[model samples]
Target: MFRLNRLTDYAVVVMARMANDGCKVRTAPQIAEDTGVPLPTVAKVLNALARDGLIVSQRGASGGYRLGAPPERITVAAIIQALEGPIALTACVDGQSGHCESESLCPMRGNWDRVNNAIRGALEGVTLEDMTAGLFVPMGERRSPAALQQASGK
Candidate 1:
């Protein structure tokens, strides 16, 4: 199945934690310790997030990272795209048309594009505020036992 890499997941976790903490400038080591992520990994993710304009960084004694914009304004898709490139299910669906030689005749390309759009829509629909406030759950759906089991590898 298509899934985000562990690095991307960790990036989200780190960002979410920061967002919840009011996006105050935070040291990577501190965020790492609080979030239970490796220090080096947190550093890497912080750099990437800063580079992508999702967060800003300062150096020296009072330096650290904070959200470039308000948490409510940043969508989950922006965070994912900041660390990972565009969210494309199949390579052909990526905006780089030159990547695929079969672009002119690929029958599945349109379908894949539709699916990608749907996924993108859902991700873009969610903001960091939704995450930080524990509003990620949809109104009618509950976390199923199977889903919990899968998440825990039970």
Candidate 2:
């Protein structure tokens, strides 16, 4: 099965949290508390993202993390790559060279690239904004829960 690891899932959730708040600088502990992820894991995920420029880090008394770019400018593929490296599914593809014993005889050896690229393209179509779109109110249409409740005549 093609599956992303737990850290990648956490990375998406963490970044989505940052994106939800307009990429505001947030401490790792604060992120952990808000996202319900463990503090150590949040730190680790933030480090990985910072190393890849997916997130920016600040140092000293006000140190914290934020997205390197706005949510709409960042693609899901970039996030996945920052945490998981390239998106190729098989050893025979992605320029890895000869990890598979049957590379010389396998008919499907060179075909996986098509599948990989298609998947990458699909992921690229989705932005962090797309990921967080339904999580809260829109820019102009923002409304509080109480307001919505009263409007519903509850």
Candidate topping lDDT: 2
The residue-by-residue lDDT of candidate 2 on 13-61, one tens digit each, is: 9999999988578999999999999999999999999988989999889
Candidate 1 displacement at residue 81 in angstroms: 0.6
Candidate of highest TM-score: 2
The per-residue C-alpha lDDT of model 1 at residue 55 equals 89
- CA shift of 70, model 1, Å: 1.2
lDDT of 1 by residue, 116-148 (tens): 889999999998877665423454776776775
lDDT of 2: 0.88
Work out candidate 1's RMSD over C-alphas: 7.0
Clashing pairs in 2: none
Cα-based RMSD of the predictions, in order? 7.0, 5.5
Measured on C-alpha atoms, candidate 1 has an lDDT of 0.83
